[model samples]
Target: MQLSIYSDKNYLPKGMEPVPMLYPFWTEFIPSEKYPWSRLYGKYLEISNSLFKMTSLQEADLVVMPINWRVIRGESWRSKINKEVESLSIEFAEKVANSGKELIIFFAGDCCVEEIPVKNATVFRMAVYRSKRKQNDIIMPSFTEDFVKEYLGGQMSLRHKSEKPVVGFCGLAVKDSWEKKLKTVLFHGAMLTKSLELGVSPYKGQILRSQALEVLAESPSLVNTNFIIKDKTVFLNTQDVEQRQKARAEYVKNIVESDYILSCRGSANYSIRLYEILSCGRIPIFIDTDCVLPDESIIDWKKYCVWIDEKEIPHIAEKVAEFHDNISDQEFLDLQHECRKLWKSRLSAEGFYTNFHHHFSRK
Candidate 1:
């Protein structure tokens, strides 16, 4: 069942040039690509046609707005997003409303839970709070490269359960300065307040990350910790080429060395590390804080990773050990391969699109 998609560039917000209508068609290739620090993902470019095809609006099963709403909101630094949406998006929705065509929209960013105000539409976004997510709001995985295949020549080594589970993390956790610490505190406070209203846990990303590391570090009997904790954020689009390469190398090494990677939300309610760990064929000790993961209806995410709730942060080490102890050596080896296969078939950009059309055709 191929989903026929129609898109109009006229609906694109001001100053935005039209790109490919479907996200997987354009997002897989960006200038200065850095997910796996390589551009080998171009190979999957051919897979997009298998599930969806472009068509006329009159014949389309889904109508796309062709504008990345996150980009529009980010560019208008001073303009209110609500005003922009009202002026730019309402017309598009109104045009499609009478046509009786279901809309398809794309949003990418951390904490992009803003309402789209379009009825009968399916929205795909990077971050979506499970409590706030509408029925049509689908959470998508962060775009990533197959790290094991890209770097390790497609070879995956299994980490059998020893006496202790080895948990690893290599990214920003400790706040670098007084200002950053204060900002994190304020952010956590806001989340706490929001949690009360939404009836969810109030665990913010950085704090939860720090606490998880501390818990693992203290419990030497339960887990062996291998962490390269950074005070300042790096490995992003940076000016220092050498520093970027070094950070990227360290990040990959950390994941490869450990049996379980500590995957937590960063600035968003979702973690890109979760996808990366899966791509590397390793287990993720995911800290769940009201996150809506992609393909939840079909994929049993907990089967591939060690899932820990926010309230269970203190017992994180024990949980990791228990999960490790429960699985036999053969099962552990098989899980590593299974994790990689899951990412290749369901999480990667090619995998997502190949299987995603079924999600809409059923509707």
Candidate 2:
């Protein structure tokens, strides 16, 4: 199905092809109008003044909107200023939905995309690594489900499971300062330096994505770190930090070689890796400080996994040793089996995508 994504010219779905994109984020790294299935904003949809002007909505089957992906620069809860950008985008989305074309928003699982009114649109969430919404419009089409199915059951369709543990992240890296109203950016290098000071170099803390791949590619014993802070309620990733692509690569490689992966998060938001790890067939060592999941969620969690208190991290080495010696191979495989079953029933990519596809088609 041709999905026309209406996002800034810079927000290209990396490696996303075949799915048609009507607009692109204008950026240097991403070539505009040159790539197939993606194009400049002017080529299809146009948005300004809380309005959207477009001619192709009638013919298009669906609209994949990366809406609310840019709220980082515009609002702060403590600041007097409201989230102007989010307000504008929400308005624009309403218009598109009212146009009779089913709009599918690529909302972050953990962001405020929920603020947008869905009167007519069917919001579809694609979690790269983490999702924040307690109840997303739907949770299918997860890379977890796709990854398992592709390797386990061969299909001829264009879609296949995404590679496990991609180095993608969704969180705030910077925020608009309250005093200056000027956005303060976090540099990646700064965060890495801080991680080093903590004596847990990000390079060593549960490495993922590219790092995990390398580790898995080499062996199944790579150590990767997961990060989560108690609910600050911001959607942007840790900011003002400089992105060192090489370091990220090395980090992911480390995880790829390890048998266990770290799944960490804070306050109401679980680590995005929870879904990723279960789907990828890796043992996840969950780090939870105090939050206890519900009986159903807990049964589900225990049916396939392990959990440790955040405070125990200091003694993680001993804990790891204990678990290694005590856990039976059958127990481990049972965890994998239940985890995969949960993924299929509750978090498969195909299930959600099909719902999204049908929703758009009906309208």
Candidate 3:
């Protein structure tokens, strides 16, 4: 089915595309010849240009809020939206509401505003708790570059079944400093004061990550672990170009070399690494913390990953070993290929938007 979209040009943020979330579709990028991460964000998949038609408001199926909700500059736990942008958004929403149309708002970052002021809008967010998910709040997948196709030139690093599965992780697990730990404590405390409906966790993402890694690492007989744990979240924060590139290469290498990549939530409620693991045609040992994934209704996400609940974290190693022992070597390889295909068809930036219109139609 074809979907037509419309957005008020006046509401779009200055120097930004009409639909920033679908950047690769309308914008041209100069290929980065140097760093691997530099080449990571652009043009991983090419889709038919006719999937979505940009049209006039009266002819459009959906109204888009050209203002990117996630890009508004804000402070940690206290970011404020731009007054001018806010006024324009409300004005645009009022117009759409009067026209009797539903607005599609894209919020892509780790942290989103506590709420969107508009009522007749569908908010797609990357970091949302399944329990707290509203009818209009659709849990969207974190867009990722295709590692196997983009980095490996379409050559998948498929693994054969062995006595033990190789589980890997390379990112922030523990808080690096006392200051950070204190901040986590303050944040956790603040969350406790909020409504229980928010799905607040006493343990921060880093603490939970460290606990899972420690449990897996402790059980050497059950699984073979290949971890590069760091105290600080360096991949995004590191300003050094050389260091960032090296970290990116290592992160990709860890996923490719392992059969099962430990995918857990970072600062956000969802894990970007989970998508990366799928992009590389590897199984993810997904640790579910009352999380919702994109297109969960259509996709049997359990088939792609070794699903683990938050309470089952301590038994992660045994779970991995059991999952590995059950699948035949050929089944294992087939799963890897299926994962890559899933990402290419539904999880990639181009792929998601190509099939995303059906999501609204079902509503």
Candidate 4:
């Protein structure tokens, strides 16, 4: 599929570099020459370059306007960018429609929805943090990466499981706030938190996560660590850089060794750990908190991992044990291999856009 990119490169703010949406923070640490950060930003810019053929708008199948607007709360550079992008998006949409080509408004922001003027257009966002149903067409929540290189490197030895089943989790266990409780009551639903003036509520995951941690803490087969958070502030044992690195190393090791790792929602309705678990070729005990996965219409998430609802928090141990006991040794190993294959083929950025391009081409 031929995709044309339209952008006001000269008008971009100072210190801003032209890169794809949801660019990883660790890109600075890893030299671009040695290891490229996915296919969109760095040296291995194969996926975007191959799939999206940058050409004149008059002769393109699809037109993409990359918007760097971030919908954050305070009066900052984000707010300034949001305003600039909003106007630019409107202008771009009009031009694309006039040219008789489908427009893709690619937003590198956390906004739930940004309404464009053109009818023949699709909006893509990084974080769909809104509770209400979106008005835009084909909006997707792009996933972020933390340690893709390390996770992929440790995939070979990740198939070996311990003698006994172990469920592991290493992240913040936040508590629900009173405001969130009030909003839940007023809205008559926990998932929709727009009434509370919040993009995404931390309470949705916190409630289930805290309950699961409580139940799993007593279980003999669980290897977990509760990084407690009081009022959104995480309380860790040590703040030293070396200690933090050691802790992260230990966390990854646990995820790689354990039979299943707890994949629960955090600030957003989705968890980055879900992808990391798949990258490591390990099963994820997905705690569904009214979450939406990318390409849900095509991907059968249940077939890949054990899906558990928030209401089933009490019976988590039982559910995991039942799943473990039923599967044969060979089946377990196969599932591990399948997890890695799924990540590389569907979940990763390259795989995602490749599949997305194919899906778009069909339409």
Best by lDDT: 3
Return the lDDT, model 3, position 108: 73
Clashing residue pairs found in predicted model 3: 75-79
lDDT for position 208 in model 2: 23
Span of 10 residues, lowest total lDDT, candidate 3: 194-203
lDDT by residue (1-363, candidate 4, tens digit) is: 534444444333444544353123213323345323443234224445655555566666666654443432212212323455456556766766788777666544323333334465666653453444364445353443424455446325545544556777766665557876875564344223322242444356666677787787777664433332333322245668687667667667777657888888764566777887887778889987656666666778887887898789888877777787778888888988888788777777666665667547556
- lDDT of each prediction vs. the true structure? 0.76, 0.39, 0.76, 0.59
lDDT of 1 by residue, 1-363 (tens): 578888765666555544333545445334354444234345455666666778887898887877767665542122235456456766887788888898877777654665655677778888788877788888877878778766778788667667778899999885245665666566556545544222222235777899889999999988999999877678885779899888888999999999999999976688999999999999999999888888888889999989999899999999999999899899999999999999888888777777767777656
lDDT of 1 at 138: 82
Worst 10 residues of 4 by lDDT: 72-81
Give the per-residue Cα lDDT of candidate 4 at 141.
39
Residue range 188-289, candidate 2, lDDT tens digits: 344344332211122212222223223223432322233222223232343423444433333333333345555654211335556655554555666653
User: Candidate 2 overall Cα lDDT vs. reference?
Assistant: 0.39
Runs of candidate 4 exceeding 4 Å displacement: 1-14, 19-44, 69-81, 107-120, 126-155, 160-164, 177-200, 221-244
- Summing lDDT over every window of 10 consecutive residues in candidate 1, give the lowest-scoring window: 194-203
Better of 2 and 3 by TM-score: 3
Q: Sort all candidates by TM-score, best to worst.
A: 3, 1, 4, 2
